[model samples]
Target chain A: MTSTLKIGDVTFSKIPRVLIAKPGLDGHDRGAKYVAKALRDAGMEVIYTGIRQTPEDIAAAAVQEDVDIVGLSLLSGAHNELFPRVVQALKSRGGADIPVFGGGIIPDADFADLKRAGICAIFTPGARIDDIVREIHGILES
Target chain B: MLVRRSLDLNSLASQISGDTVLEGVEPWASRVRALSKALSLLENDPWLATRFLQHPALAKLSTNARVVGLTGLPGAGKSTLTNLIVGRLRKLGKSVAVLAVDPSSTDTGGAVLGDRIRMQDHFCDPQVYIRSMGSRGALGGVSRATRGAIRLIGLLGYDYILVETVGIGQSESEIVSIADTTTLVLMPNSGDDIQLMKAGVLQMADVYVVNKCDLSNPQRMLSELRANSEARGRGNEWTPPVLATSAAEQQGLDEFVDALQKHAEYEHDHPEGRAIKRKRVQTEIATNLLFILEREVQKMVAQVPDAEVNAVQAGQLPAMVVANRLFTEAFAMVQQGKIEKNST
Candidate 1:
């Protein structure tokens, strides 16, 4: 009774691949590393680009990885500088439809700003790890 | 077609799982080029990602390097600014890596990968490494796997890493997630500039620069920026400082660098800020993972027979009964695999 159906080519996958990268120079990657581990444990494919990536590089990798979700981890205080660039590059590269989400030391008030700029969710500090994984699933499934 | 293959995937998995050091560091120059090629292949080949998901380096990369995002409106001179920042950081005796996000090649699913070509001065300089990425159909305007590339850069021992976004309005904001800080660049008197302002530019700004300051009406635009900031008030403990610069002339950059240094120092001193940053990371990971798991479960359940579904629908059986049965079967499959591993 339970063996005859299939969901897409893969079974109940919430983005099988993740492209994780840093956008600019602030040289702190502890947060990104932790998140990669969390995502990997959750059974999603995680490609963690350690540090110092351009938005183009990140976007290119995301496209190459055929990732369902694009997760950017910024601690350089330069998210404002890098987010839009990656977004635009992705859009230009025809990846404007892939779900893009991110987290970092963004200020509280800037949360809405990041969203309006096109990020699905901006998880500031204090956001639960479970919440992050959940949001990735939510964004992809939706 | 996607069933377990003959090759020992488990062996490959075990190879990249722990602290086993991967060799071939010295040929990083060519290795990075190959890495880029492999990554592109993974993007086009779904099986590639599935196969490499177990690679230890893919997930176990370090976090010691700086992650920066360089953003500005089109023609706001981000390329010039990137050159300047990289140049300055180099003069300060820091090794730099630039992750440039560019448009993709439609035919091959690859990027032109041309940012390095533009920054030719640093090409011969071993202190700098530049890599370009294509967005490749990601929503919210950036690629999904940007962090992975950044991690690789850090692992290579670069002191400072820079990310330059493809500057499009609104959608460009995904950079906030990957950068420690973001600098928003603008120019005086562009028609669409007002549109961006009204679209909530103030909040996306960690540092605001009125680029092309050498152009006319710089003061008036600066005043407008100030007015906007004043209206918003000093909302956070760290007030985003506004500066004027001409990326073409390379003027006012030292002050910008100083301001960036000051903000970096402030973040270091403020334990609250650090805590907040950590919290953001935790939330992103947890939320995305759960989302994926639930989706997988749903897919698994969809494989259930229609009669079983109808039985639940008709109230002959509880929905939980169906769900539990499915989960149990799935877990059993997993358990069986684990047992097989132990036996092997």
Candidate 2:
């Protein structure tokens, strides 16, 4: 029955809050939902905003929820425009320190620009759930 | 994230002072960030949050803010109605903070806090602050962080605080203990009026809103709610007002606001007015104490070594012995330091 987590010196015993959102017109939530369920199973409180969320809404919700991490999933090929916009929005809302990671039909060529845009990490279709959870914990730990 | 400091005024002040927004400036995004960060402390480390709540900055907070609770069945448009109410309240020049609660999965402890989805209109408005909360296995609709968040919102000088419960239907009675006015939002043709009337969560509301009035048979539903609410009225006591609304069509909102104001006046003028406020304070105190104890227990459980757990599972160590050892350490830690600042 014990679900608390401890990493390094910090005990993530308090459920780490996370937000997984969709920031565009695409309604494909299978990926986002899977990760959300994964994170929840990993004992984190995950907030999922169904679909068609604006960047400002996502960032505002993240800051308001006081989430430790934010995960965005988009498949409309608009990651170039929207991912950085979400990062920018988070920064404007004083959430620059909140790690921004993403998933969906993103290409390998787009990774560097997106990272420069402030997306800390990206997960593609073949990415394992364990890797996502490990990467997120690593992000939170750092 | 760990609550990284002792949260004395100097520490909290320094935490926010690092931002460009100077101190004493209340109307800025940094203020929102500060409010949010405090809530994180409340959620992640309640032991530290207790110290923050006791700080001088919170000691002098204004006690005038009105707390309204919106509760009903899920998908009953609490968020849409709350958005409309926020729009109306802002037009009346009143600032509002909404704490929308969503249930965590008992299996996974994750939640898809979708209530804020409908409230996109007020996302960027400085006068309106909306936060989504996960229930985290706490029953009675709202999350455990709710009471502390209310205090933080009150400290930030919001004119009104809206608490949107998880709306588990029958058991969400805790709203009555937290909000000065509880608005029960219901849908039409649900037969909930007569059925849920005996269900207990239906009786706590100071106001009843049969939202989505555009649906078929809404008038009948409204009349049913009115009829049921009228039967609960006693001599000279404040009878809950049952109203109808179409949030999409923007109907019945002004009357809703007036009804809320009227109920507030009733509470303020009631012979036993202090009873409601006293109940709310009691709930807050109980929740804070629970938060501290539960968090300490979680920390202790996390610190249990794999060897001990394996020994217990293998029947090498008795469960009671292991539990006693854990409790002993947790109690000693509690005695040693009430706030484990920088333990992260």
Best by DockQ: 2
Which stretches in model 1 have alpha-carbon errors above 4 Å?
A: A1-142, B1-61, B105-114, B190-201, B230-236, B283-344
lDDT of residue A64 for candidate 1:
38
DockQ of each: 0.02, 0.25
Query: lDDT by residue for model 2 over B100-127, one digit each (tens)?
Result: 9988878766566778777878877888
Residue B333, candidate 2: C-alpha displacement in angstroms: 20
Q: Where does the lowest 10-residue lDDT sum fall in candidate 1 chain B? A: B1-10
TM-scores vs. true structure, each candidate: 0.54, 0.79
Best by lDDT: 2
What is the C-alpha lDDT profile of model 1 across B156-209, one tens digit per residue? 578877888776565567776677777877787644336546654446666778
Off by over 4 Å in 2: A1-13, A24-28, A50-54, B1-9, B13-27, B192-199, B272-275, B282-344
Each candidate's lDDT (Cα)?
0.63, 0.79
